[model samples]
Target: MKNITCIEDLRQIHKRRVPKAFFDYADRGSYAEETLRANRSDMERIKFRQRILVDVASRSLNTTILGEPAALPLILAPIGLTGMQHSDGEIHACRAAHAAGIPYTLSTMSICSIEDVASSVDKPFWFQLYVMKDRGFVKALIERAIAAKCSALVLTVDLQVIGQRHADIKNGMTVPPQWTLSKFIDFASKPSWVSGVLRGKRRTFGNLVDAMKGSNVNELSVWIASQFDQSLNWKDVEWIRSIWPGKLIIKGILDVADAKEAVKTGAQAMVVSNHGGRQLDGAPSSISVLPEIVQEVGGQTEILFDGGIRSGQDVMRALALGAKSCMIGRAYVHGLGAGGQDGVATAIDVISKELSTTMGLCGVNRIEDIDRRVLTDHLQTNAVSSPRN
Candidate 1:
């Protein structure tokens, strides 16, 4: 197998390995995909200053995130259906993150259950939640997270309604993929992927299936679609905060006004994300909106960033722009789809090495030392031209 050197390389391998339906589920964004493209392009526009004549020795990427010490200021964002990428994908990713000294976040819709990941990994991983219409189920899920020793609770405030992804509709994407002639033919082409799936017992959404009473694999998609509470508001955030005793993170905040409100809601941190551009096609990129969100809530609460972060340089750019840390969804998922556990390890190593090299080249010795001075005014102009600006 060729060495997985970057996230793009992983994506290439993933495309070749996984079925068209699963691959597109993780790869594609919502209609128009304007915000998806903008997320990456906006980050690239921020030029870094090439400083010289500085003793860049004994560099350290070491930093603390939400009171947890990390090898670097980066977190693995929660992505649903990771198991489809690889067998027990969440467990593998969480183990890789634990070994790398970074936080791994388990999604509310993950194929692996909270207990499944918690029992497999040495360190306690963070748990992400979606506010559902069933308050009893939500409460029980929080209690289960605590039982699993999850260090933090990430409440995804957006996604009241699922966005229309043409690929998913076209592919008829669902858990335990329906066996059609085309799908069987697609699966037969990849013997290695098939073997991995057969070796694992949990092939569907493990968390949700067991969490809800009288629910089975066949009812998962319908249950999830119906459970997403449309009436979720700041009052619900307060209710969640009251139940979750650990660190609280409000995810999916793109607006500065929302960030300000999040701070007021007593959240310890807020993720500046556009749901990876899966929701709100016309929304601004996370990188483009990050600076403003930071400016508004930087002092009041920690600002974590997500959306379009595909490499280590992107992580550095986000950190330099005032994000305390950054999260990646598709990058690691690509690795999981490509080669399972080894692929995820390779992905993390690639990003960490890239982060170190980029920091050295930019004359920044530590992640904490990186700031706006290291970047050019090109990002500011892009931000100004943005529709939200």
Candidate 2:
């Protein structure tokens, strides 16, 4: 733990500690993963304008996200099957986020139920929603989040139809992992992981278990597959707004036209994401389209950035392009998978320190002071305007 210096260090530990199926589930993307590769490559292209002889002694990372004060401009992005990465993973991640004074967003597909996380953490974390075919069940989930006092409702609008993740297909991924001789050996190899899961609050999807009272893991998977709601449209956002009655964030906006529509929906914020390249393999990277979307709707509504944020420099890049805050999924998930709660804290600390160092070197002492000026050579401008493959 003391030797862990970067998110990649945690990721290496995660791959070693967790089962291969769950580790690859968090590490890989769908189809050819072209967009997934681009998300990182494009981010790496941006270079900072290192300034010297400027007094950055009073540097501060404090900023407000969604009108709420935060220690840093970061939020934990929602990830499905998080608890599989570590036992009670959502609760542990939420607690880590709260202790750092940053908000955590719990996925609807989490192993720990909304109530489980809400009861464990004193702060009101955010809740992410995936609108299924069953409107009644969806409404019930919303009600549960409200009852749990979730600070914000993040509506994921991209995954109306599931993408073909070849890795998951090849791995035969399943909740509680399907029993096979090979799987038994894999589980046996990671005794600590098995022990933690045995002591976990629930083995299957905590939120959906009650809804699937007599169903097995296979039956639940089939049901969830059948409930993706292919007919989902913008009208549904209006419907959700009518019922949710709180801060609403429309996630998965990556185009200028959709950004306009999200602004029209009157959402408090909209995330520019490509579902972390899990949905559309050939789509543009989120950061590449961020400037255009922000230009289109920056003032009308707050724009949050998602997709492939691995470091604090990435967060600074997103903010410089007009994101109110950045959300991270795989970075912290790796930490959770590595060492549970303490690993998550380490992930946050690494990024926070990196962001502060980046700010100081770039001659900025405040979060708002970050902008295009911190960058050198207009490198990002070329990337944003260049042709996409």
Candidate 3:
């Protein structure tokens, strides 16, 4: 194969290798996709200042996240059905993240079970949780992560109601996708993906099946659909904090008020994400809200930025805006879909290089040196006047 140097290249290859349903499931966003498009566009709008005539040697991307050292300020965000991107996808991705000296978060809805990943990899990975109504199952899942020696627990709190992704509805996306004539024809066109799937276990939500009582692949979808508790409140967050002993992260905090609440719940960190624009179509981009959230809670808790982070420059932008670290979903998912382990490694390399190059251009030698001065916000010119003033 050719050198996959950029995320776009991986996306193209992924389109060629994975089935349409699975590819779109990872690639596309919810209705209108306004926030998704805005996430990228907003990053582009924040232009960096270029500098010259300095001995730009020995740059470092090293930083600390959640009190642990990281090779860079990037973490692999948990993406469900990672296995469908490639066989044993979660395991391979986790391995790649470990090799790169970064943290890998395994989703509660992943195709690989917690033990499956733990047994296959040497180091511990973070586990993401979506609070379910089944208190027993929730307790078991947390215990499983603990048994797996996970160092962190990321509690995703935004997806109380699943957003309507048009592509998912159109593709009839599910675990072990329904065998329709259209899907079969799509699969036929991708023989390499077909071969990989044939060699691996069935493409069901591996983490959910055989673990939750009375739930198999056939009933998995119904169970998942019913599990997410819409009545979840701050008390639930407190309950989760009380149980999970490891580092706690409250994922999906978009508002500053909610971010403060996360801190009150004793969360060590909060990921400023809009569920990657999958939950709410009109919510502001995660990057746009990072500055305020950071300004509010930076001294008290770790702030992580997630949505629309596609390059190393994006990581820098997030840090400049006060995010301690950034997480990637579609970018890494594109890499996973393209070439599995190697693809993921290539993706990390590409972003790391991009970050280094961007840092050098902006005259910043270290990741810690990046700050708001590197960015010129055009929005400042259109400031709104307060009625009280």
Q: Report the number of the highest-lDDT candidate.
A: 2
Better of 2 and 3 by TM-score: 2
Return model 3's CA RMSD, one decimal.
Answer: 2.4
Per-residue lDDT of model 1, residues 120-197, tens digit only: 878898999998998998999999999999999999988998889888888988887888898899999998888887
User: What is the alpha-carbon RMSD of candidate 2 to the true structure?
Assistant: 1.8
Candidate 2, residues 27-112: lDDT per residue as tens digits? 99999999999999988888888999999999999999999999999999999999999999999999999999999999999999
Q: What is the Cα-based TM-score of model 1?
A: 0.96
Worst 10 residues of 3 by lDDT: 380-389
lDDT of 3 by residue, 100-119 (tens): 99999999989888988999
Return the clash pairs for model 3, or none.
none
RMSD of each: 2.0, 1.8, 2.4
TM-score, cand. 2 vs. native:
0.98
lDDT of 3: 0.86
